[model samples]
Target: MSIDRVVEQIRTSVFSYKKLADRLAERPSERVRAMIYLKEIAAEYNLGTIEKFKNLLSFTLVKLYDDIDFSLPTGLDLERIVKENNVVFVPNHQSHADYLILSYVLFDRFKFIPLIAGGINLNIFPIGDLFRKSGCFFIRRSFNNNILYKLTLEAYISHLLSSGHAIEFFYEGGRSRSGRLLPPKYGMFQILIETHSQLDPAVRRPLLFIPISIVHEIVPEQGALTRELEGL
Candidate 1:
């Protein structure tokens, strides 16, 4: 589907709009306004995953490291599992490069590229455009108090999984500064859990949370992380 269409699908999905309308029932005019805002948010988070761009960027991204040692020795037939279930990759966050690397490896080895859920902070100039085209959907740092935004995100994610699109997001929420796994943020987890529960049993696909451990011998952001750790 075209990127615009994919976004429209999320914006118009009954999952969010119905609940939003009910929430704003007292102020009927707000329903129209809220829908407009939802459309803009959906467009903002659109994933424009183009294979040509992914392939080109993957080549350049691979050159940055000496070698990326990827091994899936579980012998679980991941390829078959991906076809049968909704795969959600929960990888540790270390460097900004972690985003493209995992997606690259997936496509290169398994011929499947999952959309990445990235922080809205990274949605800056030139690079942000590149990331979006390569399948990174920008999300706000916090939207707990914003009912519309929260529902929009949840509905967006719900549509992605039910429609058979695999996704990847960092369980740690942000890059780990201490070179160790930090306590995981439960926001996304909650959204996924709730969204899945709401789905009809016949249409709901099994969610497979794949935990990935990425160890960088020399993290790309080690210098900056050390500086921040020392209260720089």
Candidate 2:
């Protein structure tokens, strides 16, 4: 289904609930509170016009910091991988800048702009709207036992994959506060596996799980993370 149709279906079928067991998995009061967030996230999937914004972002980044230098694993052929299949890009979590850096790499190298999995927390404020327009779709950090919420997420992801859109999500789950590699969290991967199982075995094998590595010479979030750890 198209994004508009999918978003509407989710809004009406999921958030229109009146109780915990109902559509949105919340009481009326809770649903009322989440209305804004829910809508913001739904609108987050709107990703038609992005090149203009992406180019602008690249320009701003160049002025603020040094150019980003990253690399794909040796012997891993991105062109060959995507020739006959969709890609589920799993990159390491390091800094907030990873989004733009990877986006630039994907566009410049492969001429692809993927649907990224972003945190719902970042789905706030003026910047959030910009990021959404730049092709981000929000994902809450934890599902918190809400099956309908999980279903909403799965449905969104499934829609993108089935539609042949390349996807990018941090296999490390969140930014590494310690500047160390966090063990990969496979929850999202598991969901994709389940989605893959529903596909024909031949097609399933062709879907590439591309593992990308990002190394930053300098990280903007470094100072803030240190301060946060110091509890000051």
Candidate 3:
């Protein structure tokens, strides 16, 4: 589905209805402002750009690493699973390249590209535009105090799941600096759980989470990681 349709669905969602109505009744300006904010935060998944970027990403990967090995756990039955359920992939964080490798391999092998959750820190000028077009959604690193931003993000993600889009995020929140698995971040999981509970059970499809572990022989950010560890 197009992003416009997804945004419409979110705008008219049950959650949005009450909030929008309440805002309209209390303050007209606030209502309009809320809608504009939502529009800005929603992301588009451009298939054509994603396909083209994969070739460039692959070339870059070849130049950086000796080799990348991809394998699925036995009896995973990925094709059937994707057909029946909305999929969420939670992979371990290792290096910045973890996301690029995963996205490329999935597109190449299964033609299934997932909308990845990326931090707003990486949302720079040219690179940010490229990433957003290639199915990356920018998110604030800390939004504990921003209720509106939180709700909008939740609605956007909920719309994506209802429309049958796969999602990918690092459970560790950020790349591991120690070359070891970090503690899981519960933020995305909490939003997903609440979203599932809000759906009509009769019509809600199963949401499945698949864990992925990528092993890197030589992390691309090793030098940076060492420096940061030393408080440089």
Best by TM-score: 3
The count of residue-pair clashes in candidate 2 stands at 0
Error of 1 at 149 (Å): 1.0
Models 1 onward score TM values of 0.84, 0.76, 0.87
Cand. 1 TM to true fold? 0.84
RMSD to true structure for each model, in Å:
3.0, 5.3, 2.8
**C-alpha RMSD (angstroms) for model 1:** 3.0
Model 1: CA > 4 A from native: 1-5, 14-18, 24-28, 31-49, 228-232
Order candidates by TM-score, high to low. Answer: 3, 1, 2
- In candidate 3, stretches whose alpha carbon ends up further than 4 angstroms from where it belongs are 1-28
Error of 2 at 115 (Å): 0.7
- Over 155-209, each residue of candidate 3 has an lDDT whose tens digit, in order, gives 6777677767888889999988568988899999998877766665665689899
Per-residue lDDT over 116-168 for candidate 2, one digit per residue giving the tens place of the 0 to 100 score: 88888997788787777677888788885966566556555555555567888
True-vs-predicted CA distance for residue 228, candidate 2, Å:
2.5
lDDT, candidate 1, at 149: 73
63, model 1: CA deviation in Å? 3.8
